[model samples]
Target: AIQIAASRDQLDPLLLSQAPGISFKYWKDATQLYLQQIDRLVAKGEDAKLAENKPYGGPVFRKMAVQLSLHDLKGAVTTLVDARLFQEAYVLSRTRYMDSLAEQTLRLWAHDCFLNGHYNTSSVCYMALGDLSQAAAALGKSSDEESLSLAADIAKVLGQTTFAGHIEEKREFIKSKKELLEKLDKQVEDQDLKDLPSRSELVIKENNTEKSQLEEPEKDTENAKEVASTDEKNLMSDTQAEESGKGEDENKIEKLLVELPEKMEGLLKDGIQNGMHKGDGDTMQNGEATDPQNNNEILAKPLQNGSEPVQEKSATE
Candidate 1:
């Protein structure tokens, strides 16, 4: 039993060796038999005696309940129902702390039974809990009593009595949908099967790309070296001259920058404070400023020869 519980995923031939009296040849078969026997005892309403057989029953049933919770309802319901029966048999002795959990477990068990098309079992479960609404609801009966003239549709359906089979059909449809969904999920998984690249192969590709990009620059440098080799004397002379020309350009730029602030300050002060003479009032026409005073200050600033002077400041400066 320990081996069966411990290694549910793996084969447990050791259970057969351990419990030689029983046919524990297959773990699945063994567990199934154990479950069936408990279910039978619960059905017979011998729940008190069933609970007394704790050595064989309690753990098996508890495991089964967990399995059902994980959606293995078909495999687990036999034992789960028995466990509920056992709990009911000892309801008075059962811990107050565990009452809600037991009720919730029974409710889930009822849902599983209904989902598996055991509506009679579901009805029994709900009836035992005194949940008439759910019991009748499971049976396609009305939750509320109504006057004959204002009867619920469920009452009408129940009166006809063919609706009992409809619930079974719905259960079967749910099973089929579950199977279909399983197949589709498997198909999706199969479709997305991936072959991951080996780390060494990925590393090799990355290293090759890096090497190629590095070699490209080296190749261009080599080409430049070869061209320079072919015209060594001319290359050397041209390089020296180019360097000298750059130095001269830098010096000239420095001189311009040094001279610029004084030149700019003088020009701006003269332009703003000392007004330029107009030729004559008649020489100018319309509303325009006359003669050299008519110069556009903003445009004229740019014409004063700083290559990249900004417009607004140069105008006001």
Candidate 2:
């Protein structure tokens, strides 16, 4: 009847009570046999379909239950750990006064969660393990502001002030770093805005440069022509002015030549009249005729002596 019930998947407390001679050792063996049979039948099914069915009322639970009933705490914990039910394994170990097993399970679970990026779960496991620094470090790895804040509060409540302070400092550092990045982004945007010229202005400047470049040779040629024309005009005007000036100079020289002989004859006539008047006065004062030849000889003697003749005074007394 027990074998029939185990085949029918009816391994309950009532069945065990009805069969008082059957121990948990026999029950564990029967359950494992039934699980093996179920696995063989489900082997051809898809993995999802097989996972959906709890073989033999969950192999881990059945084995753990059997081990617990047999007072085999270590076996039960081992069963839970093999099933990857770490939290339950730790709890069972702790409740059974297996301190070393509980700590070992917790550390294993924490490292597993940490390696799998389950930072919050790892943090809780580390906290349960009394490793406040690792717990805070795990929370820091989560990069969730609210989770870190909550962890800081929990740390404070647990009297882990230093870890709580470290968590707060890390949060502040992250916030400051975020603000600094935002400020740098804003500065970069502003600088880009300042450095970028308007499209129309840039186009216009490019066009102007192109047009100026294209027109330079033409403008240079026109300028050269204009300069040549101006230079020719200036040369013509300079030559005309020089010719007119030369003609005026020649006219002045001709006029001076025409007046020079007349001027010299007039000077000689004036000198002769003054000398004749002096000779008449001298003749009257001496009561004698003064000859022109003697006057000529007197003027010739003063010229030879390079001196002027002394004038004779009239006797009035």
Candidate 3:
């Protein structure tokens, strides 16, 4: 009921009195309500005199209320810190004199910011606490080269020579690392370029090999064709020579056949003449008169039978 009334901004003196008891259990809620009420009253230009004239009257009551409110606010700030709400806790605590609580909250907030990589925020927090060294160190965590270099210059101006030198050294290291990576990349590109011609040559050699492999059968076929043509030519020449030799042999045989009858007739005539001479000599020795007609018949009979003429015998034999 009290929380409901607080939320509605309808909390009376009766509910406000119960807030102290609520602080023991729900201190953060109670503190928040009390601070809101205080803010409202201040905004309305309410003074201590107006506060005292209310049902919660008297200076003693006012003082006790202030003390209790302070205690509750402190508890609320501690709760926020425990919840890792350091920024809220720091802001809440810084508005009042919470003794060492504000400084503790600022430190916690700075550390949280640093861990979360809010380097600039952490550096501001550290600077607010008058910690120049920690502030410069926080700024050094930034990735920007120009920011790091600027931070180094700022650190030097602020009399933090050691931190400035560290920042400068880190900046140089980052630059050198980047340069080295660029050089390595360039070298890899150059190597790839250098290998391109050899790779092309290898491709050409492979193509030539494949072409030769494909043409080998054709070359073999051409050689076979040449051999076949040469064989055909040789066979043709041999046939022509054989035909020519046969023609010459036929001519020689035909010539011999054509002259054969003439040669036989001349040999027959010589044999007949010798037979007549022999017959005349024999007739003279025998003293017989030669019958020319009978000799002629004898010669004619041999000629008719195609035989050589026989010599005439003596009349005594």
Best by TM-score: 2
Off by over 4 Å in 3: 1-71, 173-317
- Which stretches in model 1 have alpha-carbon errors above 4 Å? 1-90, 93-122, 126-161, 191-193, 215-317
Per-residue lDDT over 1-317 for candidate 2, one digit per residue giving the tens place of the 0 to 100 score: 55886675444453353332347577666657556645655685633433343455476787776676667788889888878899899988887789999999999999999999999999988888788778877887766778889778877877888988888888888888989999999999998888677899999999999999999999999999999999999999999999999999999999887776566555555676696797678779888665666555534432222233443332321
Candidate 2 similarity to native, TM-score: 0.39
Q: TM-score for all predictions?
A: 0.24, 0.39, 0.37
- Backbone clashes in candidate 3 total 0
Off by over 4 Å in 2: 1-125, 128-130, 137-151, 159-170, 186-216, 244-248, 251-317
Model 3 clash pairs are none
| Angstrom error at residue 196, model 3 | 26
Reference-based lDDT, residue 301, model 1: 54
Superior candidate under lDDT, 1 versus 3? 3
CA lDDT, every model vs. true structure: 0.56, 0.74, 0.74
What residue pairs are clashing in model 2? none
lDDT of 3 at 60: 38
